[model samples]
Target: MSRRLTLLVSAAALALIGTPAIAATPGAVSADFAQTSVWGGGYQGQYTVTNQSNHAISSWKVEFDLPAGTTVSSSWDATETVSGNHYTFTNKSYNGAVAAGATAAFGFVAGGSALPANCLLNGATCAGVVDTTPPSAPSNLKAGTVTTTGVALSWTGSTDNIGVTGYDVYRGTTKALTITGTSATVTGLAPSTPYTFTVKAHDLAGNQSAASNAITVTTAAGSGSGSTWPLKVAPYVDMGSWPTPVLTDTANASGLQNFTLAFVTGNGCKASWFNAYDPTTGWDRTDIDALRAQGGDVTISFGGEAGTELSGSCTDQTQIQQQYQAIITAYATSRLDFDIEGAAVVDHTSVDRRNAVLAKLQAANPGLQISYTLPVMPDGLTSDGTYIVQSAASHGVNVSLVNVMAMDYGQHDGIDMGVKAQQAAQATHDQLKVIYPSKTDAQLWGMVGVTPMLGVNDDSSTFSLANASSLATYANGKHLGELAFWEVTRDRNACNGSLTNCTNVTQQPYDFSKRFEAFTG
Candidate 1:
């Protein structure tokens, strides 16, 4: 429940190269630039030069453009070369030759203004005049022939008065390749990982064109997301509920590898676990650590039936967003469930605020997944529930999963609970058809999920062991997005009375959990 500050980078201002100072024959000696910044009395800089022969190059004016909050960083010894109006940069042979042509290193150490992050210069060639006009941007950059380890890329060529001589291909920020043709393949990438690429053309006069439109492409099969659950079946566990269940013990007992820890509420615009523990201050982390140690992961779910969800309690949207971000970062979780049931569903203002935060988070984090857990009827999502999805879509928040609370649907006579749950899912899918008419049926199925109450539900209908097994089968057959139950603690017990702690009518200790855990997709 606090504010955190992050510094981005001290980046590129200018790259002014000078002639090599030698008596006989002048050649390229050293192309070094000094970039300085002060962050908590610390300094760091990144340097990339084509070649340096240790010549005392003079008259090179090093400039600084410290753009705040730009990205990718840390604090190191400012490498303090000198102080005052001038700077002398001493180089460190940190990394070997980057790619085939560039020598990359870091320099800078002086007391100066604090700067934000990630600045990069394309490249330059020493020219007599340094021509002003660069070529037009490359057109229609596209990816083709993707493999497990590489992807082939091609783009339409650019033209200018001086004429285009070469093309520069970029993988993210780093220049990956330079070619005469418009097509090349970037290799040595990890499988199943997403990569961003762009293309820019340059003239013989050393003027680079603006980069073309970017494309994000993925390599085939396998995962790079370490220590997180890579599957689709993660059940909910009430962290603030009775019995205060141990996660590691639960995993060992039920053979479940993934769990969704629930209910990070708010206390005066600060995130709290039911107003009891501050999530950022290492609260209830021992179990989480132990669970991760065993190759299992937990999704940190915010906003439950608990009264003050962060958005509802806090009018300041930024404050609420920061708390949500902090919790996600603290857990290193890819999955986040917003349980927008119980009053919060109808709280449209809060819903919009939450959606805005989610949209930003998704855009900033490429791999982070977001889902909405809403109350559902056998017929489908209520009007309020549909509005939540509609608003999220309108705000540019891609809904990863729409999980339905398939429990407590009043009284039903003689109908199988599993069939009722399926009905709710089908109805919801049909509703999604109206909302996202462009999406295929299979695509809609992938967005649907159902979570039912185990053992005896609050209403007259009881979700029996048969119901759990049958529901899992249906979810697998449809290739659904996810399958979760209410709370693990309730399923762990089989006692009478005490609705919150135990499932009133059931057979084995964790029959329902085992059934749902069997879901692999």
Candidate 2:
């Protein structure tokens, strides 16, 4: 390849990617082409997808026409369905569920000048389906229960030609909330002030309907929390491994009532305990019931280092949501943890889907807490782990805590394991401050959780009993959200050096757990 050609490719790619496609019809799904690279014979290109509808879409397929002799060699992040020069790229299972007002994209390497014609997204024109009619106005708008700073409202939905996307709830002329549901709570109001609200329907092409029936309501005289998540001091227990974790016995010994059970992975769109025990059938109900009987509870973890997460198998958003909802209902637990380590942390499609699903779960079940236990280093979370948290925040998931698996730094060179865990927590707190700028210093610290591998790490360093004590003291001083280790069973056995059956150091059973049990915010 010519150096000049490389330079040309870079410039052309930048210019082409920067060019925007004018949407002829607003609020409609559209796909825009971008040339990412160039060569003498062919080039690499990409298409950015936009979902302008007020409601989310579960899947999308983009098809376009290329001139004779122009062909696609390969594609990624989307499944390709092609015949000759007509190329159709459909969303993969993980990336298919694009939220309302969200975007998805795919890329490909091709054999020509890098532009395509007759672009269509799910059989509609690339510019978006051109429909000019406005939706019917929402009917029977009425106020519901009022709080000190907010008031709830609901109304009958509207209809449209191209399909009604969502509704805009207006607080006297100013748009208060844009929501897909007919009901919503308008917050941030004076306690005793009366306000009038109306709603209007909107279509896919950005057409707004007439104002709905108005209603006035005065907020009550006291404050109440809105969509809150709980803080927990739960430690992890590997339920999938042998011995299967006698929860009550561990709880009895460690005096740690809260447990984060490991891994409820997918059994083909269904929830399974590491693909062995079906969670819905209450396979482990006896242990959970006994644990709960002792005034303790468990947080069902959804993903781990092994097998596939639900989104990897359940392509339908509704089915996946049901799968998760069933587990929550079955366990009757308020907390959920997503252990995203290994390759799952960097998988953006599943990350986004998980965040979206958790957001909905939180909405449906208020005070439902969610956390991500991610891979970390002494310095901080890797770039991929940071992106995982960023995606959750962007998707409106209420993150109760971000637990860093502070283990397995591959170098042996005289590292202070305790100091490394503290540094990682501090660094993660700082990153979170950037992601959530409005949160206070105290709030950011409260969102931190540090989990170091006990006994001997899988690397050159070791986490001794003293290190656990030091980390717990540090966590308590900062009011960190949680303190946990890799597995509860390992803390019981006496063994040496990086074995799952035992902590690599000499210690009595429950020594590590007892140290971390006192951690509280």
Clashing pairs for model 1 are: 8-117, 9-116, 9-117, 78-109, 80-109
The best candidate by lDDT is 2
lDDT of 2 by residue, 1-521 (tens): 43122223465558754454334356767787766676788877778788776656656788988898788888888999888778889997568768868888888877876478888776667787756789998998776545445565667889886567667889898997665556665655666678999999986666899999888888664212222223346777888767677988888888888788988898778888887887764567667755654456677887888867887667777888888887775565567888888877778888888888888988887556678889988778899999999999899987878899988988666867888899999999999889889887877877788888887877757888889889988988987878878878888775664476778787888889888876765
What is the per-residue lDDT of model 1 for residues 68-155, given as tens digits with 9 covering 90 to 100? Answer: 4232233222232323332333332233223322344444433433442222222222211234588999988887655445566767
Q: Residue 67 deviation, candidate 2, in Å? A: 81
Structure candidate 2, residue pairs in collision:
456-504
Q: What's the C-alpha lDDT at position 441 in model 1?
A: 81
- Taking all chains together, each candidate's TM-score versus the true structure is 0.58, 0.57
Candidate 1 global Cα RMSD? 15.6
Best by TM-score: 1
By summed lDDT, the worst window of 10 consecutive residues in model 2 runs over 222-231
